[model samples]
Target: MLDPDRIRVVAPHFKRRLSGVTSTVVQLIPAQRRRGLGIATLGPGLPETMPALSFAQLPALWKKPKGAAHRVWHARRNVEMLAGIVLRDLLRMPLKLLFTSAAQRHHSRYTRWLISKMDAVVATSARSGSFLKVPHTVILHGIDTDLFHPPEGVDDTIAGTSLPGEHLIGCFGRVRHQKGTDLFVKAMIELLPRYPSWTAIVSGRVTAEHKGFADGLKADIARAGLSERIVFLGEVDDIKPWYRRLTLYVAPSRNEGFGLTPLEAMASETAVVASDAGAYREQIAEGMTGAVVAAGEYEPLRDAIEAYLADPGRAHLHAKAAVAHVRADFALAGEAAALEGVYSRLLGVPATSPQS
Candidate 1:
């Protein structure tokens, strides 16, 4: 054991193993293909090398409480079996807790309750951490630079649509309710006229809840008569070129567990102009890396965008600086080493050298 301390790791069920395996291949499949700001810097494996566990075949369900109780019983037994598969890890693994999604208010509460049974906890972002009363460590997620790095070159074919003076700004991520696309779209409408040539791009799949919100954005864009200035690229397999063509990255999420999209943008060398979500507290260095407007405040975001548009040299400097900061503070190897240390500490035994 590396640390010899009391520990436990509870891996939450996200998707079926098959689906999980498919996830890597379908998108950002490996180190070379990582995307969305922060890449391998956040976890142990590249998209390709991530550990894939076999799913337990679903047994037939029973109708009565007895049947449901039986299911619960097996689930616990299955959990123990999983613990066994992890071997001593079950004993030494840190109670390192992390939850996902932002809009699900109960998720944080329930996760905290579940983790209360353990010795320690970890939060991927501040918003989640804020919900926890437990003593916890925060390990900001990292991004895979190899995959999400800026494209070899940038050719702004869309530049022709930009206002005579404004810069091209873009945002990307899952189109979901709490992501604050409404705020961003509204801000763009307000800001578009200030910088006539400036255009904003919102890309990704908007979820059902946000579908209406996304439509509102389209309507607003049309009303502003900036149809040519604003574009929704939807989801794309590659965002690397987007990074190189953009002057800034915007993440206007109403809530974020860790704001993975910002990390992706950072990894892609696009300095952020994001909402002051709890997660941004750890990543953005205010004026250095990018502006952190008050959470979901369109005015500040627009102001920041304007400031950057007016000074491309300044924006470029921040862009390079943000990337350098990520490389230094949140690189994949560093993240892996930190996680390994936690794991080793949880294992409670020293890792021996190969020859020894």
Candidate 2:
């Protein structure tokens, strides 16, 4: 637990379910703490080991921290933004509210009103920033390279299950229409038979609403006799190892909010083929690190993935470049330092260099 009095910033995760926002909070808090930022999380669904303050401890916000004039209440969702308002406005707490927006669409009137109350705003991507009427800083999302790095050796087999083929291609996210799962399946069905040594894997949850959609895709795979060649491994606890096993990773989302899977895959030393959705185009270097196709377009996506599958050596070369790209530009440490600078400005404190 972080000492309540020492906390200069509070990051709240109001939602209990694991989501992109929750994942960001989980990955970012520790990195911020490593930078000597007096930050702590509040609410459920986070690891117990993380520095956290209980709801009962909300009263502590009435007092200022050791060095800062006011505590920064950093929010990523509407509910969290509301909570910050309640704490700062209703209860008269010494807090400066900050909100980070990742949605690429225009904000509703209610949402715009909430954003207007923020002391500072951060947009996760330039596309996301364009939707904001208020001035904001653009801070692209980064991943923990240490957690998602190249494998020690070449290993294709996934322990506990029989996933054959010398090389593996993967698309990981929710198995729904928005994620373009069917497009990946269609591409695999057409290409996997031609390339006998390669297999395709789809790893993500199939929600109750998307069960029919998932069932239909499976039926198509069964009809094509590619059930063995193309597999679905629902949701797994640790996705890092899966990234390490992949030769190429694809993010075929028809829509997204600053997608991080491509960055995760690149850090795992795997090349990517992603749709021009979210911040994918900004992350991928076209022919260098990977390829980006028109969002929801079937032919272009298929052709891009085929290009990687056709030349294994080319894929390996691209994967090496991707690893270097992510390390140089998207390390978690860089994000932590950038966010710390934002927090410093909000708290009226001088920014300090992050500890190595």
The candidate scoring highest on TM-score is 2
* Candidate 2 residue runs with Cα over 4 Å from true position: 154-161
> Which regions of candidate 1 deviate over 4 angstroms?
1-13, 16-50, 56-109, 125-130, 155-166, 351-356
lDDT of 1 by residue, 171-219 (tens): 8777666777777777777777776656788888766667787887898
Q: Each model's TM-score, in the order given?
A: 0.70, 0.97
Cα displacement (Å) at residue 69, model 2: 1.4
The window of 10 residues in a row where model 2 has the poorest summed lDDT is 153-162
| Per-model lDDT | 0.55, 0.91
Cα RMSD of all models vs. native, in order, equals: 9.4, 1.5
The CA lDDT at 32 in model 2 is: 89
Clashing pairs in model 2, backbone N/Cα/C closer than 3 A: none
TM-score of 1: 0.70
Q: Indicate the residue-level lDDT of 75 in model 2.
A: 97
Among all windows of ten consecutive residues in candidate 1, which has the lowest summed lDDT? 67-76
